[model samples]
Target: MFRKSLDDLLNWKNSKTRKPLIIRGARQVGKTWLMKEFGKTHYEKAAYINFDNNERMESLFNGNLDIERIITALQIETGVKIGTQNTLIIFDEVQEVPRALTSLKYFCENASEYHIIAAGSLLGVALHPGTSFPVGKVEFLDLYPLNFLEFLSAMGNDELVELLKSKDFSLITTFKGKYIDLLKQYYYIGGMPAVVASFIEDADYEKVRQLQKEILMAYEQDFSKHAPNEAVPRIRMLWSSTPAQLAKENRKFIYGLIRQGARVKEYELAMTWLIDCGLIYRISRVT
Candidate 1:
């Protein structure tokens, strides 16, 4: 509910030379909701188009890279007059339609007047290889789980959030119990937006864990549906071992935990796939 990215979106809107924005994150991290809310609050109207299994969208961007034609069709589709100053055009799941992603290049070069934001669950993976991604034509914003202050804001603790922001150590020390209790809740709840929302509303730990498991299952489905066949098993193995890997004292990710004789090379593709899809985070060791 309280996303700091909206502040960055505001900055992007006011900039003189703004390019199309791509909001990237893992599935169910509120990327789509953030884009729509920014549009609702900041603009006269938002034209939202989802490209996931959208056949009409496929036809729309498939024809040519002519900016005018595309804009006109978008106008017809979204029922909002495409305007330079007021309308926010949101291309959701743009990765599903590679041509639409490519068309952003022409939009950046030719139709810079219009504001466009594109986002999808696995857009990061789609931009690699084969797809002619609009490399230099788009700006990117990443949405992550709520940090401590943001979590406070979501729980209607605006004053506490502001106090934390003020960086008053003596004052914070006095509020240790309150902060500690919230921090413990956050530890159990984690930071995924949906989980936070559900927890905030119902305070059901069982439901929260269920939602997380569902999200995990969706990711496994993505592995089977989207990842290469040979790597799927390796991905599952590596994924299943993450808890044990982190349980070690050093907290280093070890390939050996994935299997008795596992090597990095053997599971590198799986790791790369997870990273590319924003499913996992990797902290590299300093050389």
Candidate 2:
């Protein structure tokens, strides 16, 4: 799994005045794996803490914003010796604990020596509900589904990736069949790590579809599990409508398509929720 984000991660690791870094992406896009890989390759150890449904961690940040106390709790929870210079601290699924999200500011201010990386599938959405974001306190890296070049690398086509990056269109045109074949595979597999990994190993289209379906199901479960009760139904409705929405010639996402004569005001929050969860991509027309 040669992720293109490795270059960005390497840059973050070598920066002289680095702040806490946040890896933002859609769910199952390998944010957690990328953090672990970065730590393994660049640091002596990684202190990984997942803030979802962990009572002790939730309590750690409930009362105060002391950086030392938070570090101690993280060390205790992860059993990794916290070294300012060598250890990489990863906060995974961080949106579950709002205070932990805000604590990045203190970390930036008081514990600048420590290398911290944070990632969450719903972090953007969580920050939207008026959560105090660590505005200037952290750096951000946005991860997307594997681009065509990454797909080539994942499938052991490093030479092809090299060629594409070289931009020799005449030579590339000679191998257009190869690129087109891989592009079709990428379309059906769609850059989710698990799906791509399975397709790479087995070359089984049926298994790929099954994995995509499971991922879609997990996303629905996330809505019911983590989203506001009032917004869950709307989210589900908006999410389920995506295939139909994209199938049209004009993919601008009409609210009426979800129902007869539906208005944008009625489904605005639902659309926002789906976008927040990374289930849909929104493109607006600029006149």
* Top-TM-score candidate index: 1
lDDT of 1 at 95: 81
What overall lDDT, based on C-alpha atoms, would model 2 receive against the true structure? 0.87
- Of the candidates shown, which would achieve the greatest lDDT relative to the real structure? 1
Task: Rate residue 192 of model 1 by lDDT.
Answer: 86
Off by over 4 Å in 1: 127-129
The lDDT per prediction is: 0.89, 0.87
Local accuracy of candidate 1 as per-residue lDDT tens digits, 1-287: 87999999999999999999999998888988899999999999999999888899898887887999998999888898989889999999888888988988998999999999999887766554788888989999988888888888998889888888899989999999999999998888888899999998999999999998998899889888888899999999988998898779988887878889889889989999999898788998887
Q: In model 2, what are the clashing residue pairs, if there are any?
A: none
TM-score of each: 0.97, 0.93
